[model samples]
Target: MSGFVLNERLEAESRLVCILGLCQLRLMNDSRWPWLLLVPRRAEAEEIYHLTPLDQTLLTFEAGETARALKRVTGCRKINVGALGNVVAQLHVHVIARNPGDAGWPGPVWGLGKAQPYDTNSADALIRAVVKEL
Candidate 1:
């Protein structure tokens, strides 16, 4: 996986948080929700089926761990986990922490509204909090 590279769109939208066993954890820049992306470090792998059995298992474990960390940090009402590759084909899972009255509640967050980029201080604090759990 030395040649693994994150897609440009993902790179632009997320900040590299830390590297886990089989995936690189990224913090989404949007501040509207506690969102994280776990992208497998497999070059040219667009879907989960493209990965080996071991890699597939690792992805699931990492995603679950990430979701737990988010839950601990945010205490969100719900945690949404999915691997929708409709736009960015990379094998990445979204672990979003959702609240009852948050924007786009009772619906998907995708395309609900403009993304509110996190300010520097808040983003740093959140990174520290999430890293502590990781």
Candidate 2:
């Protein structure tokens, strides 16, 4: 399949880490939770159903693995996993660790506040930690 472009708005808003197999794994700019974004490398994929069955399976497995890694790293009580493209229109899944007293605690992380940008060193460290397991 021909590769489609990930929009600049999405890329600019997310803290992309390293590639995890078939997806370009990213950390959400929000520091509220240990949030992640998993985007397949396929182009023009505005919906998950647009992917081939093989790719769909790969994305699911990869998202789960990433979620587990995030849970382990954060020791979070809960993990919220979802794929919603209402705003950016990219086929990306969100894997977020939830805690009782987090910034968006007792509510969804979307539209509650601004994203906390990570420092280069911190972002690099997180990427290193996650990539080590992949």
Candidate 3:
């Protein structure tokens, strides 16, 4: 897409880790969970079906790869992958590493608790590690 600007809400919430074949790999600012977001660079794509056929498939591939990378980095027992655009309405996939005793526990991360913003040093280190994995 030519003018594929990131949604403002997402831009305000996350930092760019890298770009993938069909999505922009971003690190969610919250430190409580090792979370990543994959946003497809398609203009006005509010849903997965809004993307081109190739883009839809590419999004799945990129999201899965991101999840594996996140799991390796966090060593989490479970991975939560989803695309619930109820609020931001952007076509972004959430690749979150979950453990048994996390803040959200068995519930979804969204709206469970306040986000703990990552420290600058921690953010940089994680970004470097994730980029290397990608």
RMSD of each candidate?
0.9, 1.5, 0.9
Residues 31-122, candidate 2: write the lDDT tens digits. Answer: 66778889899988878899889999999899889988888877889988887888888788888889998986878887776778877787
Q: What C-alpha lDDT values do all the predictions have?
A: 0.91, 0.81, 0.90
Q: Please give the lDDT score at residue 129 for candidate 3.
A: 84
Candidate ranking under lDDT, highest first, comes to 1, 3, 2
Sliding window of 10 residues with minimal summed lDDT for model 2: 1-10
lDDT by residue (87-109, candidate 3, tens digit) is: 99978889999999999788999
State the local distance difference test value for candidate 1. 0.91
Candidate 2 Cα outliers beyond 4 Å, as residue runs: none
> Cα miss at 134, model 2 (Å)?
2.9
Of candidate 1, the 10-residue stretch with the lowest lDDT total is 104-113
Residues 10-97, candidate 1: write the lDDT tens digits: 9999999999999999999999998999999999898899999999999988988898889999989999998888998888889999
Off by over 4 Å in 3: none
Question: What TM-scores do the predictions have?
Answer: 0.96, 0.90, 0.96
